[model samples]
Target: MPSRSGPSDAPRWCVLGRVPGGGVARGRVAAVEVDAAGERSAPIPIATAELPAFVAARERSAPRWVWSDTPSWYPRLLEAGVRIERCHDLRLCHAILSRSEAVPDRGPLLAAARWEAGPGAGEGEPAESALFEIETPEDAPGAVPHDLDAALEEFDRQRAALAACVDPGRLGLLVAAESAGALVAAEMAAAGVPWDAAEHDRLLSAALGPRPARGAKPVRLLELAEEVRAALGDPRASLDSPPKLLRALRSAGIDVESTSRWELAEHEHPAIRPLLRYKKLSRLLTAKGWAWIDEWVRDGRYHPVYVPGGVVTGRWASSGGGALQLPRQLRPALRADPGWVLVSADVAQLEPRVLAAMAADGAMAAAGSGRDLYSGLVEQGIVGTRQEAKIAVLGAMYGSTTGDSGRLVPRLRRSFPAAMRLVDTAAAAGEQGGVVSTWLGRSSPRPGDEWEELQARASLPGATSRDESRARRAAREFGRFTRNFVVQGTAAEWALAWLAELRLRLARLPSPTSAESIAPARASGPAFERQPHLVFFLHDEVMVHAPEGQAAAVAAAVRESAEAAGRLLFGSAPVDFPLELRIGERALKE
Candidate 1:
């Protein structure tokens, strides 16, 4: 997200932190200006109430604001109608560099472990000083320090580690993209996805036979449960309990190993069909039933907490509201504002394309350059059918070594040796208890001590066969994890880059005028009131809420940014990341 400093206007690095007592009724906030070379000026203290105005004034000369944490700072600025272009989030960068393999030595970063802790590390959050406070939960214990001294020190440490890394350019890009993601997360939370509460209720009612009163089950769910119990020939079966249901199935002569849909599908019993349907509806009722609508949707919007980099693969996770678990059946509730539309887009086979580029497999790249990669493979005789190609590619990346996937993988390796080699090498390293990193340098965690000890015991002269078997099994399981980690992590990096670029491009577009018949989404905060902004993102997919006049422009920006992300990461590789795009009033899949 860092942009170039023009010839006349140089970009300054402004470090923001709390001055002691800044939270008092009439206290001051502290800030210091540091140039790119790390030269700092004298502290400039401003009144807490006037801090937003000061920040707005300083926006004329673009500044990369350095702060301890984005969530701890950016939300308040957003509330004050101030939007920053970019930032260096010390807490996020510290977490990245401390475990990054690109940094040969992370001793200094590891010693500053407080920076790696969650928000609220040392002296409490900057929010406590009223400079960045919001109505969020209290900062967790061991919060990152929010004072000027600590901020400056952590920034210097991150900068130093980045400079000393094996590839500063790549690692730096990762850090910048990650920080941008943190900002996007905060902004998206503020903007909230446009939701139709009435439509949501209608859908839930139709699907589940109306909302139930407190401490009662939905009528439809109860009916389905009874059907399942009846089909199992056990009227007293507790369908909600997994073990009890499994026992009931055995009693009915279904002979299923578990209550999972996969195992159930292998049997032809009457109970299997109703049981699968029951489980599906049960999950929906439990996860996003009427209660969910009441709790998460408000002001005609849904604000789900997005935790960037929450997954080890650098994918996002939700802390509340089950954002990641949104059911497709409820997607129609993801309606846009009256005068706006949603631009929905997602890449086609992201991981395989990343793999091709990362490994520079020209054959694979050529196959996927301008069409469906799986279809291209099928056409090129790599596999007999598109389904086979899908199975093979997934098997290669996920270390699947049984069933149809395993049988089809060898053909892909022969056709796309370089791509297969890349993942194979990663898997081999993982099996030997070595570390593997994504294309952008986010390293995998080291094998646990238990794993190491098991491997060691297996190597002993008189080790039992059980120990050896356990060690081998553990090693293979870890290998599967590492195999997927590299591809999944790099794909995540690509998504982050795409999201950041699209965000910037959307910002450059013109906002809707009063004459355009568009209304401000005030719930989204003032910064994005009438403008096109990202409302939802899940892995490779993104949805933007934009005025009718800007829907075409927003759609184009989405495509262009995706292409830009490909070039930004892979640099002229023939690999293509195609998207399935839709623009409409509702974010419906069809």
Candidate 2:
């Protein structure tokens, strides 16, 4: 490994990619340098085995690591006890810049067909057979290339694209924040969320009775099943099957078309209540029951593999353990250690805040200033009440033009015309098959070929009224998706910024003393044992497990990070991102 430190003023980047044939898990590292005179040097290749030491020595210089995908590379480095402070994830950034409206020159990126491939199988999965697998004939257009040469080429193209962006600074910030988010995702999975198996078991037992024997139902579930069967007047009816349940309901004159809970609740059937209860309990038993606990929870920690940039809108998706869809009933199992407290903080009205900022809607921003945004709307006479304000705002963003939401949206349009115009314009774009983008340049995917074909057929010389109507409905459906995509996607970017800043702040805090260490902290691994660290993150919420003595500090860091994220995204805009912070032994109930 090379050890000489470079001058502080120079910029350096290490690009890592898989080597052709190395049985010992070897790869290639290219050291790229840029001097103060704007002079660039050719990439110097180093053997893969020397990476850890080289990276460790370069840590002090803090050069950014540019790689094909963060997940593929970072986890291995982390296991080697190496941590990278900064990176430019070529795959993630390529997804953003290729379609970003801000990018003035996307031709090179758009033509890089191999750079558009979906992420590798998520963390912990088997590695793909080939690193730079050539795009197949059936592969999607613009699939990202995976080898060293392709990574370097894509990185160069992405940099050029950023340089050609309308707001290069903001777009650059977005890419950096996105890469930081990838690091956070990997670290969170590595540390795992502290979970209490016993508490989960107790909650399950209380809710659905003791775990049943091999093939039998639990006491409460069995009781509910019997009650449902009796009320339906069909002892032989299989409550477990949706088709059977629906048939039973109809035979009993329930007049419901489906066994869905909402439709069933609307009816006055004698069996509806118990059937709903039974379904809820059944869901709990199957999704997060004893089997789930035994498989996911280990050493008092629940590790979930997080896939960053997994969704088209740039939101993360979990591969396993239902990390993103953790049911509220099971939240109590998110227990902190004996000497630790969980700083669970979630922003209120995140999308609306992002919309206000992005649209530069001063009145809307003023309404949400330093208070509950919905209540602020109510106080400003934008709507009669907080509930109405919420409905209208959601309806506008979601492109609802009927029902209560639709009726209420016009009122919001009158009050917050700028904010309404922002989403309405996005909706219009989608309706016309045009692309839309988030505040930070994450572009919504282009309409599919089938969607394009539908519109084309509807516009033909002899198109039927039915064809036109179907096209119109499909366009409107897509419009609603685009309308929400901008706000939701931007909100996700803001969240990534928040997490990145908070992670850095938490790292700066003092590590817990040995005396303060607990089982959960120990199980969290070397990177996060003592210091305040983020353990769990949902869209707008994050729970940090911290030492009890540092709870106040962690709370402050959370708030500070929120503010920092707002500033990073919107500069000095008046829009506020206020978090509903709760520092407690466990996550608080809403």
Candidate 3:
């Protein structure tokens, strides 16, 4: 095994990979250094055990760690009390650059099939499973090998691909932000959200009327069930089964296609209210019930695993614990520790703001100059009310062309044509089986082969009208998807940049004092216990668990980071990314 060597003065990127001797090999690849012949130095191997000290010494130099996956490497380093400043995640970058339209010379990256392997044990997988041991999809290109040589090779390919891009600077920023998001995801899982089990139980009891006996319905649910059955004139109606409930609703003269809450709510029937209530309670019971509490919440912390870049639009998804879908009713359960506070902040109308910047729509940007973008639209006289403004903006992004949303969308197009044209063009591209890229170069996935076949068949010489209609519908559906993908995906990128910058700023904040350390030790281990660390993150919202003394400072950092992220993504663009900040002992309402 190679021994620890002193830190180098020249910039370098360390590629880590497991070796044969139950140890790891650290291969040093030059980040910027080139010899007189303009050739980068070969990788130098270093032992895994000596990584911490070696990394610590090079912390000042800020070498980008080139690793196959962030989860596989960062967690162990964090456990050993080492925090890396920067990294280039090959797996994540490969996924981005390979499909990016900005990278014209993607031949090298596309040929690296091993790097295209779907993420293992991260998104949608159990948290307890070993990170690297999870099975790859059968059809996916082979998993990126976790050897030193492979890491170096992949890094070279990625670097070359980025260098060949038309806009390498923006692309580089996106890859860095994405890799940082991976680190934040792992750290958030380790830190865990401050959860109050007692509060959660109380909320559940209040809503569901106490836990039911085993599989039996609770008292309130039973009463509602009886009411529903009586309304349907069926004593033995099975409310739990959707098919049975639909039949029962029809028999009761309620002409509904399905028992879905929306359709049921449309009709003013005696059973409608109870049915809706029952569905809500049932969803709560199943999604965040007592069993969920026991399994996810431990020692006053809810450790939900966050999957970065889980969605094709670059949005995150939770593998377990329904982290992204946390019900507002259960916000009271997100209580801070005794001496700590929760600083919750979410960007206000992030997607529309992103749209304004991306299109460089001065009028649209002016309409959203302040924090309340919708209200700003109202001030500009673009819409009659804030609600109309919201509907119009959403309608434009989502390809809505019916009812009030459709009516309102045309008004927005008249007011903010630039922004409207951007999404409209994207939608048109999708309808023609084209690809759309986000502001940061995360391209939307191409239409599947089946979709292509449908279009091809529709274009045939003897194609039926029905076939053309089917193709049109499918194209319109996919058009809506791609329409929203650009705005939503760019917004996700902005959020990632915000999170990454905020993580670094929070890390720089002073640690909690001895007297202020009333909270129990975090599962993130000793490294983050006294520090103001990010514990929870959703699409555009983030919650930081911090000492009460640092609450104001943490809030400031959150806002500043949002501004920094906007500037980073859209430099000198007259758009603001404002955040709604809340500092409280509990994440719930007062």
lDDT of 3 by residue, 331-386 (tens): 98998888889999988899999999999999989888875999988888888999
Q: Please write out the lDDT profile of model 1 over residues 171-273, one tens digit for every residue.
A: 9899989989988998998888898989988988887888889979888888888888888878999888889988998999988788888988999987777
TM-score of each: 0.94, 0.92, 0.91
Those runs of model 2 whose alpha carbons end farther than 4 Å from true positions after fitting are: 1-8, 20-50, 122-146, 515-524
In terms of lDDT, model 2 sits at 0.82
Write down the lDDT that model 3 would get. Answer: 0.82
For model 1 the TM-score comes to 0.94
Candidate 2 per-residue lDDT over residues 1-590, each given as its tens digit: 32335564646676655444445333445565554333456766656555666677877877788777776667666655677788888988887888898998788989987777675532245344344221111112344444667776787788889888777998888899889999998888877888989999999999989888877888999899899889988998898788987888899889988889899999887798989999999999988998899889888889888878888788988887899998998898999888898999999999999999999999889988999999998898878988898998888888888998989998888888899999999999999999998888888888899999999999998999999999999999899889999999999999999999998998887776777655454553755555788889899999999888889989999999999999999999999998899988877678
Root-mean-square deviation of candidate 2: 4.4
**Deviation in Å, model 1, residue 147 alpha carbon:** 1.5
The parts of candidate 3 lying over 4 Å away from their true place are 1-8, 22-54, 121-142, 519-526
lDDT comparison, 1 vs 3, better candidate: 1
What are the clash counts of all predictions, listed in order?
Answer: 6, 13, 0
